[model samples]
Target: MVIRHGQASFGADNYDKLSDLGHQQSAAVGQALRDMGWVPDRTITGTLTRQKETLASMGFEAGEEHAGFNEYDFQDLLSARYKGDVPDLVKGDRKVHFRTLRETVFQWQADEIENPAESWGTFTGRVESARLAACATGADRVLAVSSGGVIGQLTAASLGAPDKMMMTLNLQIKNTSITKFVFTNSAFFLHEFNATPHMMSGEAAGMLTYS
Candidate 1:
């Protein structure tokens, strides 16, 4: 099972930590997983602070830190593309932010930009490595804590989905959400996508968020 990190300080200078609401969301997710009878034998998380904090909030010790699971740096990508004069559109309009992000990702995937921090192929390949490592443990139940970008790439890789599908998945994944998959020696089959039953009702219902 793959879980997204909680809502981060999106507009802050350092968006690598969870907000107060994020901590509450993480607690809710932990309780929800316990209620669902989830007994994970192994847990994994990205190197990002938010990912590690989310796992800790769930009452789990640090299992492993995988750099491959780290999210692509969008800010750096935009800075490179615009030559350090990144547009201010993402801050004002949510719709514009998503639309612009989608287009930028598409362009990045097409190799239209020169000297990117990491190529789109490289990013996806690392995500695949993270997935492979998660499945290699041979544990019946494995939990992986990561960000939306990594999860989206994993989802797209599982389905052999197109670029647009990856973008869609990335945009749709909610904080503290779960996406399950069945992995075999040959392939990975998606079982569920973007499920946040824990946040479906009550106070947590209003805590559902994506950043």
Candidate 2:
């Protein structure tokens, strides 16, 4: 199973860290997983602080740090293409932000931007490699804490989901949501996507977030 990190410090200078709400969300996820009787035999996370912190908050060791699982740097992509004059969508307005993000991500997929730090092809390759590596562990169940982008890309690639579907999934993914996959011989099949049963009710309801 792969879980997205909790709500990040969106709109902040450093988006790699989580907020207090993020920490609460992570704890709720941990409790949820425990209630579901799911325990990871192996665990991994992206190199980002948010990812690592999420795992730690879940009461699991940060078993591995994989740069391949890191999120594609949207900030870098925006700066590269827009020369730092990004649209207001990224600033605050949630509705407009998603609208613009969807359009911009499609543009990125279409190779509209030049001299990106990592091309779309490279980014996909990295994500695929990371997924394969995680599956190669040969454990019955492995947990990886990553970002929405990486999780969406993995699910999209495994199911042959289209770019638009991937983007939609990415946008809909809630913070600390669980996405499940079953693997056999390095091949993966998606079992679930963007499940947030942990925060469906009670105080956890307020913890639901996407960023």
Q: lDDT values of the candidates? A: 0.87, 0.86
lDDT of 1 by residue, 21-124 (tens): 99988888888899989968999998999999999898777898888989898877777778788778765567887787778888888898778899998998
Model 2 misplacement above 4 A: 87-89
lDDT of 1 at 58: 81
Judging by TM-score against the true structure, name the best candidate.
Answer: 1
Q: Candidate 1's error at 46, in angstroms?
A: 0.9
Candidate 1: C-alpha RMSD to true structure equals 1.2
151, model 2: CA deviation in Å? 1.2
Residue-level lDDT tens digits of model 2 in 113-135: 87788888898888888887888
lDDT measured at residue 19 in model 1 versus the true structure, 0 to 100: 98
